[model samples]
Target: MYAAARSMSRRVAAAIAVFVVYLSLAPPVFPFGAVVVHRAAAQELDDEGEFSYRRDAGNGPARWGVIRREWSACAYGHLQSPIGLSDTVAGLADRPGRLGRTYRPAAASLVNRGHDIMVRFNTDAGGVLVDGVAYRLRQMHWHAPSEHAINGRRYDLELHMLHQSADGNKYAVVAQLYRIGRRRDRTISRIEEYIERIAKRKDHEELIDEVVDPRRPVRGSTIYYKYTGSFTTPPCTEGVTWLVAQKVRRVRRRQVRLLRNAVHDGARRNARPLQEANGRGIGFYYTSPAHGMVATGG
Candidate 1:
């Protein structure tokens, strides 16, 4: 009887040890490898708007301008959408049969400020005439080091110009890729000059005199790869139309260096990684003329 009791106690101890090991090795129940899950939680706990580190208070007006006057009661929404192209491959066949054949470009619009960089635009607001149909511009923003890979290649920067319609339905985007080259962008030039002046003053109130023309000459074919994706940031809202422009714009190496020098989390990088395409179809639009319209996509 004594021997049997001793053996049973030993087995119980061994079982407990095995159970502890299993708990340690198991993946997190909520989100083992979800990047969005972690970011959302961090954003929620971060009060005092510390997550908006880019909006530096010490740098004063020079760095971010007069906040009270410029920003005003703009609804400080926590659910700001992220910008990216989708790659999911399901339910693609159910899309409108005119998916590739129908083209619209009339919807495009540009805004000078709000989030990152100096200017932002929404394509949904502006309509572009493409093959006669008016496609509205949705939204626009930048991604450092680019996002879409061309034959496994990346560029210095990329601009996503998303577009939709007047009825707040349907979606499209114009993507303009940029690289460091000899020819400079006039719009970028104006922004750089202003930034330099701001850096010199450091803490002075000044009305920005530079005017940035959103329209610029683009090289390469107007061919584009289209897909449906979600915002690249928190909330991870889905159903964003993506249009990555085939052509690439050129900016001087020094200009890129300037952007790299800006203070972001005491570092100079502000970009998100490419999300899973998840088997989404990427449509190619070639042979289309450079259509003019205002749109915003970020």
Candidate 2:
């Protein structure tokens, strides 16, 4: 019996050591020293456990930069996101342009990451061509009460369709805002079943195993706003290409409520506060009006 117990203890220690090394060996999304990348020296440090969206919380957005040394951009970066968008201040360019998109159904999974709910793609879901570069779709997430406001009007919900280049350096996000209406969003209706399964569980993942179409939010959109912004969440990585749809979709109030309740109490109203514009361009890509995508510049 003693020999058996000793052998089990030795195996447990070895397993623990292996797990520790695996975590330490993981590299940050942004590398340091002898590396080069166009997107500034910032990385998305998204440890939601260290932050919150509650107004009364101490670790709120106002103090995210001070919470960690790597999250300095959340407070001091000039090119932050979640800004107010308005064409009254946008500088339009008279040039016909189009973004290439070839999206297909792909396997995906849903997870409640404490701060919010996310749908992560497990296989290649096609991509969009921006400036001749292909940015593959990676994941999609939602924020309650929307994030970016249009013409000084905020909506009831916002969806972020995140994509990145093949090298994992460049990022482009397609944002779709929604208002509370009698109709239901088709994409949300499909995944609502899984979302309910993990509604009360934190850090829980449910294998959807089915292909979740990422193009539903982008369909029937003739007008969109293109701008350059950063991640609205932690670490706040800048230099991200933003394409916000002008066509605001209608979503049921209950759908938005489910998304809010799926996360912890601290993140129920998870939209970040509006940041300063800081003299950046906001462009509009529309089929009518003038031409293709209108340019955006403060």
lDDT of 2 at 226: 79
Top lDDT: which candidate number? Answer: 2
How far in Å is the alpha carbon of 282 misplaced in model 2?
A: 1.2
RMSD versus native structure for model 1: 13.3
Off by over 4 Å in 2: 1-48, 94-96, 286-298
Q: Cα RMSDs of all predictions? A: 13.3, 15.5
Residue 158 displacement (Å), model 1? 0.9
Candidate 2 displacement at residue 284 in angstroms = 1.9
lDDT to native, each model: 0.47, 0.84
Off by over 4 Å in 1: 1-115, 120-126, 129-135, 169-171, 196-212, 217-221, 287-298
**Residue 252 lDDT, candidate 2, scale 0-100:** 99
- Candidate 1 residue lDDT tens string, 1-298: 9999999999999999999999999977767558777666545534323223233433221222223333321223222122243223212323211222222222222222212343333222333443334565444555566756655567887675555665666555566778889987665566665555433222322344433334442334355555666554333345656556656778777766655554343224444444445455655444332221111110
Residue 205 in candidate 2, Cα distance off native in Å: 0.6
Residue range with the least summed lDDT across 10 consecutive positions in model 2? 38-47
